[model samples]
Target: MEQRWDGSVVLEAGRLLFRGRLGTTHAHAHAAVQVVVVRSGTVELADRYGGRLAVSAAVIPSRATHSLHAEDAQGTVAYYDSDSHVGRALRSRFPTAPGDRVTDWTAAAVQSACPPDAPGGGRAAAAPHPAVGRAIDRVRSRLHGPVTLEEVATALHLSPSRLGHLFAEELGLPFPAYVRWVRIRRAIELVRSGATLTQAACGAGFYDSSHLTRVVHEMFGMAPSQLLRDVQWEPGPQRIRPSGPGLAGAP
Candidate 1:
């Protein structure tokens, strides 16, 4: 943390990975859901209608736009892949709430739910439509290079529009957006395996390190350095394991 700001961080990751932080952030939205838990002090957030809501613990749904302000507060904010088991588990933490911020924080508690072993546990592909599955396979195969929607559509003998529609309908996001996520996922994995930022960026299709940083900040509301600076990770089965609460330096 910078001198002007007083903030501490704690990041623990696994195949069921997550990034937790205790700090403030400008307005931003990410592709993944975020679980914001204020252990001591309270934080304020603006809802959809621009109403200021105070909360200690809440589940911010994926892609939900919001900003936070926390100073000298003991809190834990965990970003979860909404498609993962832990993400679904956190979403179910709240009672019936139409909007963000679990209204009655005292009444409900949020827990990180997952198996002892993951990345292979409970992640059996809930396979998408056969065509979509095949499309995804193609994307994974061409991850090291460029694989546009048109090329994928042509390969599958389907019109671009039909393929785009199928991607949105079956995956709940556009083809390009999904591709970007895959690239970021690969980049993160490369970093976990001791690759430098620049190397990870180029290896994962990002133009450079700065390009990767901007995309990550736009998606996760924080620069990758702020998030990964203190994380000392060790390569695991299919993920990286942090040495402890907050490793002092990068791996």
Candidate 2:
């Protein structure tokens, strides 16, 4: 019952696992690439650019913003570290494994840069909102220091407004909001994984623990301390816990 974002839940090797029900309209963009395997259920994924596709289980590349809406009321879902050794091994066996597999291998290449367990689930793995993948890479690489949205835009060769539009249209959040969400999410993972509050905050690009706390409370509606109190870790297969009422936004 590991419930923390940074936690892991282990399953019997080769055993099929089921993730719980997921939201119908939730979208998020992460720093790492993600491979989603739906053991038993129907899930619909929609990209930021109004592209919609149905996939039982699929590998989604990094920095591509997408949402998941479960077609079956009662179904099972599993997620793996897209950048993990297990993930790579699984991808190598893609289409050959089972279920529907959709992905751009060119995007998969970016995931090989680090070992699977490098931390923060190898950087969120949920793909970015289209071409903003490069911008996200810059954000991850420079998260430790102050990096402006303008700088990210420049690196991606787009105007700030265009970048902002991409984020809003694709990921369902504006650029600054998305950046804050990512930073806070990373900070939460770090803290739950054993970093001191201050350390986690700073490491995840927050000005201070208070800053992290504010964002966490705003997004998750719970204080970080309370959130980490019952945390546990599990490995093997992805499990989607029941969503709380306030747990809005992307899946």
Candidate 3:
């Protein structure tokens, strides 16, 4: 079933469940344990630690920071909330299993978990090529520092020219252009989260606010101040509170 931002479904045995094709980069964490069984096609799961795991189906824990890359030109996934009874049953059946086998029982289980009207669809995009994955990892890790094409190429043991070519071929963007996009995207997040333009720009590894403004305008067609004008600031949970012997009536 397709879940809305605040909606979730509890799956039962003999019910078939599925999710539509989705491609997104998460800016915040989500809280839902999911067990995904791929009836057909492949999926690549990437974590914050720069590790990429390719699996046809896998169990994902709630609040784990990760992104999904669909391998099937059109990938279909059968999934359910991991806390549900159906989820537990499927987990028991799989039992930490690892292979590419698509058993009849697994197929039946998938169909049973999904709604009758759900379509068995596939992902519309390809997984990141190996070179693209490496490049992306390097860029993401260095988003808070100066990142140059030569530096990334050196880290990946590829020539600058060759790396540029590979990026264009695999990701459809020049290496430098991709890096700029990453920087701008990161800056947008920081700015939206109550950081000053200068603070956000510097945090995102841009030379200064002016550089950030230029890139933001090019990518988003808006100035940082204008884009962030309506941003609402909310206080985060207090990590520590004043206490101890001198805490009371000291002033």
Candidate 4:
């Protein structure tokens, strides 16, 4: 039989897939487009301005501040980089701005919009700029330490100003924002391994547990304590094997 888990997180070059139970959330927003595919029950979302929606499956645009309430709902939440083709396609099909678009969608429609995965686990049809790619590599390698745009630019033989421009142009987000997202991802991995909030915070290069808490809450709309509790975590293809307490059903 296929294994089941309380939660599973799969990371790729340009995508992050999370599957499991969801609880009521605080209002928050991040820099990626979110696609939720529901397997059962309904997901009720409220925007920062009092807009409300109940969806089985939905696509939320990047930077759209919203709170989610899903008492018994279980499904997959896939986050795609705003610059990736998938992200662009989703925005094109859905056509809504931040805080304005949380339209209901279907699994088949989402899958159809997703192009074939490129080699090496990248779903982005277009590769990032050469400098941006190198910068990403450098950032990934130094998630546990300070990584500055100037340092990366110097190493790549480019000026900090130029590198920053390229990052925004190619990734659709600022360099610092990208680094913060990476740190968040790393922290989540650490939490899934049973690390305490402080430990995970330090491991992911946050100043302290409080900093991590704030970032997680702002980006994901939930504190780590609630999101990582009693969940089995599955890392990406390049990381360690899946291990942790299991959920009751297949995700």
Q: Each prediction's Cα RMSD?
A: 5.8, 10.6, 17.5, 5.7
What overall lDDT, based on C-alpha atoms, would model 1 receive against the true structure? 0.57
* lDDT tens readout by residue for model 3, 1-251: 21111111112222222333322223212222234444345555565566666555554432344555544322333333222334334334433322123242333344344332243221112214676577677887999998988998899898999888877544434577667756765665565455788998999999999998776554433455544553343344211111111000000
Where model 1 places Cα greater than 4 Å from the true spot, the runs are 1-16, 19-21, 37-39, 47-49, 72-124, 234-251
lDDT by residue (181-206, candidate 2, tens digit) is 55765664565466888999899998
lDDT of 3: 0.46
At residue 198, what lDDT does model 2 achieve?
92
Candidates by lDDT, descending order: 4, 1, 2, 3
**Each candidate structure's count of clashing pairs:** 0, 23, 13, 2
Instruction: Estimate the TM-score of every prediction.
Output: 0.69, 0.46, 0.43, 0.73
Number of the top TM-score candidate: 4
TM-score: the better of candidates 2 and 3:
2
lDDT of 4 at 9: 58
Candidate 3 wrong stretches, greater than 4 Å: 1-127, 233-251
- Could you tell me which residue pairs clash in candidate 1? none
- Which residue pairs does candidate 4 place in steric collision? 5-247, 6-247
Off by over 4 Å in 4: 1-7, 11-14, 81-100, 103-112, 115-126, 233-251
lDDT of 1 by residue, 33-141 (tens): 4655666655666654565667666666545566665545555554544344555554455435433533432223334443222343224243346777788879877
Residues 1-251, model 4: lDDT tens digits: 21123456566656766666544656887767677666777677776668677766666766667777775677766777665677666656543223354443332245444532323323654535788878888888998989999999999999999999998666656788878877887886676667888999999999999998888778887666655555544343523223332211111
Q: Report the candidate with higher TM-score, 2 versus 4.
A: 4
